[model samples]
Target chain A: MQINLPSLDGTENITAVCMRPDRYTRLYEALTCDTPVIARGGGLSYCNAGAGRGCRTVVSTCFDRILAFDAEKRLLTVEPGMRLGDLFEFAVRHGLYFPVLPGHPSITVGGCAGFNVHGKTQHNVGHFIDYVERFTLFHPDHGEITCSRTDHESLFRLTIGGFGLTGYITNITLRLIPLKGRSVLFQKRFVANLKEAVEVMKQLSEKVDVLYSWNNLNKTGDAFGEGIVFSEQFIDEETSARDKPFHLFTPDMRSVLRFNFYYRPSAHMECAVYYNMERLTGVEKRCALKATAFPIHGKEIYYLLFGKQGLREYQMLIPHDEWAGALDDLRALMNRMKMPLTLGSMKFFTGAQDLLNYRGDGICLVLDVPANRNSVEYFNKLDEIVIAHKGVVNLSKDSRLTAGTVATMFPEYERFKNELNEFDPKKRFNSALRMRIDV
Target chain B: MSDKKTAVVIGASSGVGRAMARELAYRGYRLVLVARDRAELDILAGDLRIRAKVEAVVSPLDLAAATTSGIQEFVARCAADHPAIERVAITAGQVSDDDQGPTPLPLLESIVKTNYLAVIELVAGFARHMEQHAGGTIAVCSSIAAATPRGRNTVYSSAKAGLETYCRGLQHHYRDTPVRIQAFALGYVDTAMSFGQKLLFPAASAEDTARYMADKMSTDFRVGFYPRFWRPIVMVLAHLPWGVYKRMKF
Candidate 1:
């Protein structure tokens, strides 16, 4: 049936034919159909990557299930629809941990694999693809094919960050690392500005188990990037700390109402208040492991506050050496633009860059601005600065990036398109992102 | 080694059946997931075992082709294998949109067997076994379409209506016994069955519907409508005059 499919940031909504299949037989039927299809997990992508204008969007939420968990091997076999929060909770019980997890627990593992998501601890373990051992993808023409580093090596690389265009990912086997304990010493360090925040993050990246910084972009001059740099290190031993159960939060109408409460006062005020409150609060506190990994669960209302007009989320990875120059450009653009930056954050990432994968040695900067008439111009300017610095824009997070911008940012864009075309000439699996990028 | 009671959830692969299995598993009941799709059943069973720390047994069976005696034997085997089997829920149902139009005889028989005959057979088997064993609860899903047979869903609604009447009779017969029977006349549930259909009221999610059914399974409730709002609406519709109803389009 045709349903209104919205992006995570509410930037775009497309009325597409959506099918939610809970069983394997139904999923097979959905994949084998003649119509162009795309697999949707959690529908939490900031862009309209999960749905296309005319293609059928196959929602995999109901297909969520863990097929196998071998604690001895520290390997987990799960369906594409399983949420990261549910995976984390299950892993913690067995004294294992999934290192590369996105902030929102509701984000699906399939999404992470598709986007090649980088997390707070990405500097240490790399992208989500680093942990995915293998996956079984079902294409309409190709049927089911197992892709991994050893077998179908090229297909594996292309499909990892192919944005679900390769096929419908049915089964994924993830390799997990061992955890010391379920508790962490969560610390909040105050930074004076973007320069200071970068210095602190670089210094602590080698020491902290998990590291990320939240900047108050609403501020100007010296206070522009001034915010809290949050760090977490696992406790040596298991304490009697009572951790909250793992919950995959699904937003309801109440969340919208709650978001409007904080939203009407303006996001700038909220940012300043949050920054000042964190500065006043104690630096160190014991926190549950899941809390450190998924801080966005309870605060899902924040995403809703953007309202129907939505917000443009531009996440770019800038090299460590070029970050200083990029920061200057960002400040200059911020001063010149009328659009307020609703959110700004940064995380360290280290990985070998490949076909369309959002991975490299850099400080990933994420910015959210309320969508408006000037959104296109503001982001276009931001895009020029990023491309000049040889930075890569995260296609998964930003919806407004032009096809020209993406081609300019990622050198392997053409190769990805070629490989995808060679694999499936018809491109049976498709989405809005694919159509937008003209890939 | 574990002393947990087992719950059999028929048609546990999809829709409300799938949700019902998850709910029962969460409630600390060892599950017997019965469905025709073995792959789907295995996936669900594995998930329940991991998430809920409960044992789940996958029992693959084609309810449309299942015989009454065959179903009785299966129930007896389940009771014998797990003496702790204290609850049974039948959430299996089938419907074809072609039912409103001219449907083939084979399709009609399949629907009857799946929606009515198979459900009644399983209910009878479970109720009798539970009566002899420890007094267990048996709940089956009916439909709000059964309130009054309309031209929209002729055979499907008729089958559900028959199943509902049979369950009511079973409840009356088991009133003095240890067996407790609950029949849920569900409304438009957000399952594959109602995925694309435009309807007046928003379809209730299968998860929420299953949770309600699971909550009432152990209680003394005999018969009720899911999403309770459907109860009054169906009641009014059932009481409507034949002339007025015939002219209405829903």
Candidate 2:
């Protein structure tokens, strides 16, 4: 079977079954038939985060359903294949909120749990794991086990950021937060460069619910790292009974975008115009919750824009102590190499995780460098800088991770590997990233 | 042309399978269209129901993540809906086995994975379902390139050849049985795979291939040549001496 989801290219006859999200018969089939089974949910990952190298029997949870929703508990239990966007809509319908909304709408709950994905407001709150109450893991050998913060705490913690290698995370119980009338106040400010932006972001993080900066990686000289730092906080304080706004684009606009990206991304020009437009105003605006949360709603265009060669997102968490010097060196390298940083985002993380963890109490810089050129060479160079600063790369979004880089970047790599071996000795759960990282 | 007589097109989202789906629906058979994209499948199913006026069951399958029994369960569900599965056509194969440049091992293995393992499992699953019903056709879309192995497409050529052999072996297994297997040895097909490549001969459209395969599905003959004329051409090439075949570039 030929399956192409976003940037990840998977060529498999996909030997496994497409059952309703209810049953765990896939594990039995994998065991009985003597084959390896990989759980696939939503298939929204940019890299082969949900996929393995070569081909393996795929147990897809595409038959997604909302199993149970306890309004009193403010908890929702959904099939892992449920998309984050769908979950957001579901939450808002019930006058609630589910905050670990990844920028991409197509991302699933299973993928969020697997990667322990974070939002723009990570510094203010925490990663996706914080909202998760419990989840059911269909272990290849152990069968289905319900794990959470209390019962089997180690498994629960490990599985949160475990990259789907632990087992098939069939169902997830997410503790829903309260929605403040589906309205948000957005503040956008212009920062000349990273050095000044750092202090500004630190100050903004304390004031706003969400704070992040989009740096202009293309600019050099005095304008290097020049970007607009945006902040968002719910503005339901004044207004009452705010209805959620979901903007659906017309078909013609989508078609044009789909076609334009094939030739070259018209989006870069649009971003430039947006930056200039925001600079002109330099004021706060009242916006919809959807507008604030999913800024890049039409990310399918971004993936198509990358073309066949694909894109690599080198997201590194630079600690507070080392960000100043390391980022300066990285900026110099980017200027000298003339590296094509298509998109660069910097945000603050105020949490940490143990195994294959990307979280840390520091600033994380995500550089979306196009893989069209010999950019892997540039990424490798950046990895060295990350290693010096003891900054770990984001496991969920990375493309070309090596054993050496994983070992250097993640100090807990050895312990994670040891623990993983103990639980999944047969190594039933595997992916391309797992192979690359040798874990 | 009973609605009970269903046809399962494995790659119904696009290419040959999609065209085959339309052809089958026109032929008055309910369809089980399988693919990874559920949204595409849903839209296609809705369109098929309205335009084709046939029951099109959307089977959203990510084959890479599926197991053998998982496929059985998939077939079972389809059987539960449109009981009599009279035809199972698998036209879902990728030609990413081009080794002109340095290719990774995992990527190289995917050639066998997609072209062989995936299709064979589908055949085994659906073939069993059809056999119990005691009347059905198994049509597999293969390539003319498989007639003779080449270094340029080593994994694809070998896997395709292996697929043909598997079908032949199945033929021997079901010789006494009424189950029919049609191995379509196709010549140049003007698909995305054939695009930008210099064609030595006029390539067949996906529609032509699908129509021919769907019409001649129940034929007594096991192997079919799409466009019909390529039978003699591929026959000549299959018997060529290895020494001479090695020097010739496809």
Candidate 3:
């Protein structure tokens, strides 16, 4: 069952010792085998968070299924391996929805819970942990235990955003959001700079169902962050009847990016071309919910554009008061370092900080740069800027962050480590991220 | 009332059997899931029920320990409960790593009973049961080891070879009847059966193998090797001179 699986970012290729267990007994057998273990769902983390050297990766994809559903309470209990897209399709059939979803449909619910994933509606809905009512955890030392808000309260908070270090999450019960309809009225607006884009997102979040901004980081000086701000609102059933037919987005493997297509010269040209195409398109359109939520489904080649060397994504949340200054600093660093930015985007997030969870009322900026010598130094310097501005980097997205950097970013770093040690003194569960950060 | 066909999948707890159960459920067949592990079968049944929205009944029967009369009774019960039984696939096989040279008598017997004898019994019971109705498809999975017997799996290869011959004989006998028989000589499948062994080629995933089987269910192919590429390889191995084959180590 062992195979070589790569992280989504393509930087790390792990010779993963994996076992796909379909039943509870087999899951127990895999967990109690006395090897350093981690739970793997879909194997889609940008960093190799589910696999590690000399560790066994328990693949939970076969356990994907809906276990129970309460129609009145709008709550559904599902196995940890069920993909969010499948969950969305199932929920829509019942006239319900789960709003907190990452952009990719292949991500699993366990993955969302493990990383405390946020989506376009983070400012309004918060992280995936807010929707989870309870979960079943299996630990080699503690056996199977049910953790909820009122019972096993500390473990519940620790397990979410714990990045699969506490134990193996077997099943989760999540509260569902009542869906108005599957069709959405989408519109795009041009933004001049990062400041205006952030202002537009904060303004639109009050009325729109979804809000996010895409920036053209390829620009420089005053025109930096020039791009589009997309907003969408759910269409009522009567209005949706006149909309175009909706088909769920399914991921495909055929990629147009057959070689390394990212470099400094073409980076700016490509961004300008992309921006023009979006600018020329319809300002307002009717779209399917799945297509908007998972725009990366058919365009998976973007991940492979950097070729074998892969790419580095620096995603961090800066507080509202400090974001403007932080953006200026980052722009200056990019100008000096000559780092080619491939993609840049931002979303507004509103939530109180939890242990290691990437939550705060701020602007979340994500920049993807090709992995090379200068970019490595560039990210190291960017880390200092973020730390100085009191921003926290997303642990699940970046693979190269140091423990010292994390400790400074998250004030509850030592508390998370100590709590995990007390719960699992033997440290039966582990991952590559855990080892890199030395948690 | 919903009128959907029914499928009986033995050894439906793991690997190809489990994937085949899911495929059949997706194709709108209510399932009778058979396996030794009650817990595994229950989970599979529940999953098929909720995801596929099909009736899935779990029948925990150990093929190795099952009796001829008992298998017949189980099939009869399925027929009585769900009369529209249209397909049955037997995907249960056993092998012990210690079945090398000079294996223990108990292990050898267990392998023979589980791999060859039990399958023959189930095939006969289903053939008789389906003959009474509008006829049905019965598919059994054998291994390519049956064609190229190796030193590492002495007893398992012989048992699978016996099952292969028995299935061919049944196919010829039932050629005159509406009852259809398919015996798949599977190559290395990515299942627990071939989990850790160093394979000659990459193993075909259980899901892909099940998808291939489901696609071929409506066809007339009676005896074929799974992954189709294995057919020529097995033929070449079977035709090689005894001296040449004996010196070869697999």
Candidate 4:
């Protein structure tokens, strides 16, 4: 049969399938009939998590619907196809909220859970699975089964980051939190040195509910730590009513930016330097500068400082006790290597409840520099520095961490894999991350 | 007699595919247009024939339905009737938001079959005939968004990416063969499909992109990135260290 699959990004394609299955049972039957079966949801995954290569049968959970919801209790029972955005709206209306959300609003709940997604507030709430109460899944041969923290806890843990390999997630029961108010108390701060920034974040960690920072990639000198620190706390109903709410929205601006974001300077000196470069218009040198400045676009001058060579970041978590030394060591490394520092930022995280949480009990320093692709040697050197400090790299948000380094960083790999094995022996859900981390 | 050559374009009813059909006709390639919308295809065929003085054939049928055993027969019939066909371009596609409800599994399956699997089946059937006749070119349109996995439209990217990869692999397999395979990793194109979308980046006109692709098909490059300049830009973005890339607003 011919099938038409539409992607979330508005692209479409028509393919031929040998068979189709509405449910897991039907899918299993088709699989047994020599038809390759692949599971699909809203088709939100960046990689091929839902579809199979050369697979003839595709089983979709797009038919999923809400099974139950408890507004007072702040719990929701929904099918795999329920959109994360819709759930958020539903929660907000009920004076509750799903604490974690990725950038895209239209992603499916199943996708969020499947990837074991983390959010900006990962330091506090952990991964999406931490809030999941329980779920019912349909397997190829195992049949329908319910997994939770109590019963099949290992399977539950495995499926959390399993990316849908264990089986088809039919219905999920998520634990939602009651919102004090829709308004947020936002604050921004700036730091001087990397050490000072770390110290500030450690001190702020105890006072704030949510914290994250954006480093000025273009800053230099004593104010290298110049960046934006965003902290938010849920406001009381009375306070919310007094202030105007700034609803965040994304607009379409295509023509202005075809392929790259334009870079601007933060200070007069930076603008002078940019202008001076424009004056030295030799073809070869100008091309080199343009390459270095490519990654830093938009209005952020700090980022453009990394130049166009492109930038690479080495971000990791340090235990609260080790944070001070980690900062000192990082500074020492930078001094010893004479590294051209572009930008740096520090964020405080209140340890998450999940075992795979990277934010255990300290702050994370994300070091950004232009990536020198020609020199694989420097990446290894940076990897060594992070590993020697006993820091764990966030694999989901990384592209350079080697498999060996990732294995060392995430010691729970064996445990996560064991859980994966118990759930999906065939290793159905896989991506570049899995291959990189050797998970 | 004019040595203008001839090309067959499937899915020429509307959108980027229709634009591509017109583009090829404008370039003086005798056209063979196939699509599910017969009336629309006829109108397009007539326009191209009148406007460009290009010989046109409007073969309209449901590509999805034809894939079920009938597709092979259909291709054989086309080859027998249109002996002058030298190049075959597949552009058939479909779009749905699942707004009506959850897309039934059957419908999703049909989409995969039409947009992806059927292309391979049709290519295989056409390649064999084209190969026996000595030489021909096959061009499959795909998208650059396939470079990154998205939360929305997961299956659509997968299919396009998969097809692009498959075509690349097939090109390698047919290195010494007379048949040439070209995969177009297109970014957004200005078409009805993108009518209301306020895209983050400027989109190319289908006509401009199609003309570029058609002009470059005879080149040694098997995979062509439309607008050419985006190749290195997207390549760098795709390989960026995730930590930094994730921080920036897309």
Candidate 5:
């Protein structure tokens, strides 16, 4: 009853400093506190990087402001709170663009840097961390430190995909690339079989700057294992003049329903029905469907259809040569087990400097599974297949990846551990996943 | 509506509970926030503590466990810590529509215990403490679906209806006393719990509903229907004969 309420859960108690500081000195003083600290952005990372665990305090830098932008240098120096979407919009206004952005719009620049997030065009450009000119971070031990390739190279390298284990990222200067044009040529092609899909993706990767695939593993027949490969290429100035700028549009009800149903269906069937009928059908039909599916959505759908009891995501990087075989194995495994995978697909990344970058020279298969007990065997089987190919997994997206698999996947495991230990020697920012991965 | 009043809200991590938490915080009420998800509760509590400058205590607990006795102990402790805890809000019920055969009586009983019984217990424990001093407020979250029974959510609606009726009786019993009993007859709100579901009626935002309910708490109102206007409309509709009400689609 008379307990002290920590601001957020996970690693640190962030209740004390959730407001904007008037001066840099004040902010620095807060960061230098004896309690272990981690900077948080949009609070979207699945793991405990933002919240950590058992840490005395956390400094949320989501309120950081954009101090300056040098259009001529194609560089922008901003506080951590500026969101990736907002940054991208700013770049677009100046006829330049931030080449890398994750799928979610609400993610912050600090988070992207902390995770070194890769986008669809990662195969062509590489991780977002590579574009940074330099960044100023406030560390509890080192005080204020500025890092870049030319400056604090080790700190810089460790910060990317570091999960904020290094220190608080205060301000970062990101290098922007000139956009050929605002128009992006978009195309979606359906692949028939695993081999065909792999071949088509390989061919498309050569011709396209951005490529990703979505496979509905549950559908049978000709469409069974069939997936849509989306390709995009930046247009030239002449093409841009003729074509319209790419405008972001919110998907309509039907599309939204289809996306939610096929992508990440909730545990509840009534929820699924409500989503489908309300968006896909007329008002009268929606009412009728509600009558039949009143309490259709609940924990059972999540527990039975999805996987176990918690949230589950497994993402692994397969080299270009092994992509076909991986896809084949994946298809066979899904079919043999009759497991319903909401999403199964391959993503192409250019490459990343981080030794542990999961996006290397090939396609990455990302599977989003519900954390249900029944789905454990399927996940274990899938993990075995991914490991056999010497593929690496992204810890940021994984909730169910076993420790053995993680140790084998991330090549720079020891090095990352060393860096994390140096920053948080007490291991204060530990979580279930962090403890499992020994990070 | 007491000056510098305090309230404790369970399931305040998101959805209706979160809305109510924000509403009470904005009105300058100290809060004790509880939920299973620590990350969400922390972020919410942090925002409220700073933006509203109200004291907040975040405690994450699994409500469906035997350890929940500790929650009552915690509530009693909070009441002792903050004498201003003049209001208690129970908004921690869930809706599950799984095909695990017919809704079992045990499941229904669990809903009743969580939505109704636990509330009564908490009220009794807190009310006894508050009775020694001045009277306080107890608001229970009951669904509007309780008004009309439907197919899927038979057990859920039944439990909510029971809770609403219980609150009505409690209000009558507490008449002329300083203590107030209120029931929030909530319709669908845009929340993560109801993310994929569509509402048959026009849904009110949790923020708006919370503000409406909190504002009404200071007044003589005992039952607050979200969106204000829906009150008269639903009251008339609930009074309609089953022959006509059942024939018409919600």
Candidate 6:
């Protein structure tokens, strides 16, 4: 069967077969087939963690359920098919929460677990595996194996953020945040340029709970990093103390259309950001925590804004020492390629703990470039810049990277393959992204 | 942990019960979270501990099992562990098993046991515990389904109706005592139960519904509507003539 999955960046996901697995037994059975296999979650990953395309792809959405929940212990044992929205709803309702979750609610537990995703508060809270107590895996030959800190420790680290290369993760036991309040205290400060932004981040790194910034992409000449710095703190209060508790999200087509039609970071978009940044400078706002969880607008709208062709998201982590120099190389590459970036976001990472982790004592910069003729080569060059800087490309977000390039970047890539090969030596497990990167 | 004021939140795992528990926790109340899923309950407790910086204990019980005395045992456990209990919020609800044709009697019985009988047992046990403390508050969640019983969700509606009736008696019983009981009549709420479906008019978010219920429960009102908009809607529907109401679709 012909299955097409278009990423948020407009690249079509063309695959020969797609298998929806309801149980771990079924997933194991599917893995035994002759063709290469990969698992697809909620499909929120712009990066190719699913590894679809000409492979026997098993969609994991049907595997959804809350197998066990220990709210006090803050442990969630769930199937990979569960969506972040459901988990967030369940967690917040219980006065608990999940950390380092990507903004889009459609992102699945399996996807986050596989990629070990992080969000705005990552610098403070850490990655997906930070909360993961353990995971239940289905090996092609070994059957079900439980991996955690106490048991199968290396396998546990390998499996987490391993991009499903190790085996199929059927269930995950995660530690969660037991938050008292349903909201966060947010503040936005404007910076003059990248220099000021880095300085401010250094000062606030240990002080604030939430920290990240949006770049002034619309600016020309020297003001590339000049934009808004958004910082937030989780308020400690009873959820009941608020005057208004329920702030529902309703999708409006008008905003979607506007973004789709005229939402590029062009002069008009730049002007909007400029005024918004000017007005929001030094202003602190408090809102229900969910308000901050997703973007102030919504992911759906931002998604729709990409239009039919879609946009490519290239995220890379550059060391703190080379951060400014790397940005110079990046801007030059974008200029040389003539592919102007639509959006850019920067966040601080303390370091990575997972086997194939992106976190490091560095600055992670994510760029949104409209998918076009120049885009692929531009991304490839971006990978080169990261490798040169002794930084790592966010494999979970990069579709253009190759195994050769990733090997040079992530020193642990060879070991990750060795660990994976030990379980499925024939290399039956794969995804389009993993294969593209030659992983 | 024990030094803080304690609140025993029933249905602390999801829906309005989950919301109400979260709201109360923000008010600086130590919590004993009760639900069938101990894992989820503990997750909530963990959240309260981290976010509110308060102690939240988990007490998971099968609300439907009768002979095993799920409610009695759970309350006994609460009294033993959290003796300073001041509030009890029941936000648990149930629906018909929609899997096969013609819902079975056992499933209907389970629905009633969870939605009605288990609730009464919890109130009776907690009411006694609250009798020792002054200004103890007990809040229960009813539904719009109770006002007009329809054929589709007959068991669920009847269970809610029975619960509301019991609350009336509970109010009378606790009239002289400081233990006050509040009933929340809520309309359509956007929750996991209502996931991937379109709901009727006058719907609100779970966070909003939870916050509203938590705040009002602290007041003197015996009964309240979740969004407050639902009160008029339910009132107009209750007064509608059967002939006209029967012709209309829910």
**TM-score winner:** 1
List model 3 lDDT by residue over B1-250, tens digit each.
2347889999898889998998999899989999999987887898788777899999999987888788778877877877778899889888888999877998988888888888888888888878888888899898899999888788999988898899889889889888888888899897877764677876887878998888777777788898889999999999999999989988
Over A150-186, each residue of candidate 5 has an lDDT whose tens digit, in order, gives 8988888888777776777777899999976656565
* Model 4 residue A69 distance off true place after TM-score fit, in angstroms: 1.0
Could you tell me every candidate's TM-score relative to the true structure? 0.90, 0.60, 0.88, 0.50, 0.54, 0.62
Clashes of 2: 14
Please tell me which predicted candidate would have the highest DockQ against the true structure. 1
Q: Once model 6 is optimally superposed onto the true structure by TM-score, how far is the C-alpha of residue B139 displaced, in angstroms?
A: 1.9
Comparing to the true complex, what docking class would candidate 5 get? incorrect
Per-model lDDT: 0.84, 0.72, 0.84, 0.60, 0.63, 0.73
DockQ-best of 2 and 6? 6
* DockQ, computed on Cα atoms, for candidate 3: 0.35
Best-first order by TM-score: 1, 3, 6, 2, 5, 4
lDDT of 5 by residue, B62-143 (tens): 4554235775786677677767777777788766675133687767666666666666666666666666668887777887
Candidate 2 chain B weakest lDDT stretch, 10 residues: B95-104
Off by over 4 Å in 3: A1-6, A13-17, A236-259, A269-273, A276-281, B1-4, B95-108, B142-168, B184-190, B193-205, B224-250
Question: Chain A TM-scores, one per candidate?
Answer: 0.95, 0.88, 0.95, 0.69, 0.76, 0.88
Encode model 6's per-residue lDDT on A1-439: one tens digit a residue: 3455444455645645766643345566777777788777866666656746667777786565566777678887877877787678778877788876776676788888788888777778888888888888876667789999999998888878878877788888888886756777888877877667878888888988888888765454677567777788888653443443222232222122323343433534644655485575547866777767766335354546656666678888888899878878877775566555566778999865334687787898877776667778878888788878888877777666677887888878777777777867777777777677665
Between prediction 3 and prediction 6, the one with superior lDDT is 3
* Tens-digit lDDT track of model 4 for A1-439: 5443322211112243534343334445654434334555545442344544445434343323456666567778876755665576566666777877754454568877777775556676766877999998776567778999998887887777675667767778999997755655555555555556566666676676566665543444555455455566665533213322112111112111222122232333443454345336431211111111112223333433333333455667776777666656655555455434344556555554243435455667765444454223554675666667666665433455565776676667667767767565665443333544555
At residue A309, give the lDDT of candidate 2.
52
DockQ, per model, reads: 0.59, 0.02, 0.35, 0.02, 0.02, 0.04
Question: Compared to the true structure, candidate 1 yields what TM-score?
Answer: 0.90
Give me the runs in candidate 2 sitting further than 4 Å from their true place: A2-33, A54-61, A237-271, A280-282, B1-250
For each candidate, how many residue pairs have backbone atoms clashing (under 3 Å)? 0, 14, 0, 38, 29, 39
Tell me what TM-score chain A of model 1 achieves: 0.95
Candidate 1 colliding pairs: none
